[model samples]
Target: MPWIEVPDFQPRRPAQAKAQETRAWYSIKNAASEDEAEILLYDEIGGWLGVTADEFVAELGAITAPKIKVRISSPGGSVFDGIAIANALRSHPAQTTVQIDSLAASIASVIAMAGDRVVAAPNATLMVHDASGMCLGDAAEMQKMAEVLDLISNNIADVYAAKAGGTRDEWRAVMRNETWYLPEDALKAGLVDEVMSAKQAPAEDEPAQMRARFDPAAYGYRGPAEPERPKPGPPPARPEPAAEAPAPALVISVADALTETEVAALRELAQAHLDTAPLDPPATTDLDELADEQPDDWAASLAHLTTPAPWGQALEHLTQTPASSATDA
Candidate 1:
């Protein structure tokens, strides 16, 4: 009964330092601010598990790779944190390539700009808007906060201007409109260097990741009409063997989408603008200009100056063509 013998005592080896170098870390987290609430929230499932500026720098430094590829699919985060991360990437010795595999909105777009080459998936989206944050305290404090926000916006515009080869004022105007860009639009705007590889056919089986969804109205934004959610169905049966050789596949292009050559031309046009002229700050602030420029009501005032985006024109053309074609017939 007392024959139980214990194995020779062995101490566990101390964790080896830099034993395994990380090539990539999925930056699928939010850019949360450093605060008690944010920290606690990040700790919990409800909060976005974001990589802070310090953490991003540390990871980049720790990795010994000469080239790094960062994959981003974030809904933007803290502006300062994003900026810090961008600077870290920019200063790193390694050649960095950022792949926007999915969405890269708000400050995430700024971070994307830091890459030596930024590539976006055809379906990826990039959004830019004026810097905004909540404020508290008295009127004086509010005024101070507004001024700080304006400065921050200017700083962001400067970053975009440097990367996208546009004047700071032009970028700021785009920001004020809260613009969203597809891959082609991004390429044209110099937001992305190139579009990602071609799309693949739908797959029957693939691992699915949980996607977060929210009301657009909550963010003061509106998006395209949502497609109906598909119900889970039984997998399709295997097709019967064919007697004859399959006919050559017929490819049909969507009328609304851009062609590869067109996208390349847009990229060329964007590259040509690399020698952008610097802009002087206007004599008056943007707010002052807005007042002076828009004496009419909001709808009528913006009409004279607002030029419809190419994508909008494409959509309208696509939508009307079928009806007009039918009428002609």
Candidate 2:
């Protein structure tokens, strides 16, 4: 009897371009705590410059931490790669926690379900839709592709049904409509276990900052709602000086005294007059003299220009010519 020797199998390394592309999309690092690790999926699932399933699984396998955290901000990519990554995470020994930092759309939303506990930031968004693909061939090939897409969509619907509280058919309907969920909505739907609110006061532009991290619109999502700009706050109260003489009352000029609406109305009236009334060189010269010589009186006279009658009277007084006289002349 003769025993034949078996050759050792060596896996082929990915092409340099492929390796660089995948490296751009994800990072796996040990957390500050020795027993925990973190993974960031900040790009699409699988494409040029996106994370690939094989690369992700290989890196994930290298981590020995008992607990793992996967932070996602992606518009999603290849569905098959996403499925593979999700399954790998689901089967891992470590207790996995998924955090949606900004967005998890399409297949990325599917990967989020692999976590034992899924959490989302207050402004984070999750989107789900029926699986889609492109096929170029004869009628048979097109039909086959359609079947494949339907099968993939069914599997995705099952994943949703398993995580959230609904039948696969119900989830499929929602997916067909291309549903998007905010953190709270996701919680209600059982897609996320928690919507984590900031314990401390967030930065003034926190929502805008979070929004900058991902653009759901690029992937055909409506994207997160625009962050409300913070209103202008009143100036801080000044401390009184010790035993000082009372200061003169602050004087507000006529310009400052006018409300914004009044100013706008006056400007509109002036613009209308300028547009319609013929320019009189002599009247304009006299008005300029009045404005320059008696500036205080000019301002005080213009203050009454908020009303139509007062505005006409003021304009007549400034030009020293009534509309009737000008028309007759």
Candidate 3:
């Protein structure tokens, strides 16, 4: 006998982007497709998200305004650059707000937390992960780089811990273990705040999408699914092609090449020659012989051997000086 009103149930509008600590909101304008090989050439992850580290820091410092906005949608960048950006954010003069209009992942996640405020799109995503670097050098240098990486990881953990309102250990556990999070999940995990911008429906993910880096031909991750319980099978037998006398192509695996008795012997002989034979340095012995044929003085025929390097001064050192006035007593 009474009129009933229906309750409004529409979603609330997303908050307008507040000017962040840096005053200026910067975003990366160019990023290749996910299928392309990412070159950390500019040092800002796939150049996704928004501003590069250089631009971000320089702009952040120049902001006279109270708040700055960092518009991000990156797939992430080099861990080194990410840390540099993060360190900048951590020590910035003003508050920094990192806004993920799309995704901030891997090293980008580190850069995002360099903010006093972190927000994301309604359908955005974030992933936390350990730092990785390609190092090549002497064994000692490689080992030193490894230690440096471990230190970087800890420093990154400290930033995430501070921004997320979480402990360093808690952050490191998730990061070191490669935790990926949906927007809501990231918010729940304290990696970010509320999703700020609205978005269309999240893209349907393919199985191959996660393997963005692996070469499909070289590292086949997907094929016909293997049997749930793999059955024991004989090891793959490499094909033994019929030999031709003086084959046109010498293509062969090193293992197979060495397995040949004649090839092995030849390889050993070559190695022995390289190891045991004394290689003559560029010497004047031959020049001396040629000089003797020039019909000149025997002094001209003298062997032109290089003198040994001077070592007397470098091999030992001794120094003495008068005692100072105070010490002489």
The candidate scoring highest on lDDT is 2
In model 3, which regions exceed 4 Å deviation? 1-56, 90-94, 197-329
Q: How many residue pairs clash in each candidate?
A: 0, 0, 15
Task: Identify the superior model by lDDT, candidate 1 or candidate 2.
Answer: 2
Question: How much lDDT does each candidate structure score?
Answer: 0.64, 0.82, 0.58
For each candidate, give its TM-score against the true structure. Answer: 0.47, 0.55, 0.43
Off by over 4 Å in 1: 1-51, 199-329
Per-candidate Cα RMSD to the true structure, in Å, reads: 54.8, 38.2, 47.0
Candidate 3 residue lDDT tens string, 225-285: 8669877999999999988788477675655533365455556555754665336543355
lDDT of 2 by residue, 116-216 (tens): 99999879999999987776778887888778788889999999999987898999999999999999999999999988887757779867866775678
Q: After superposition, how far is residue 61 of candidate 1 from its true place, in Å?
A: 0.8
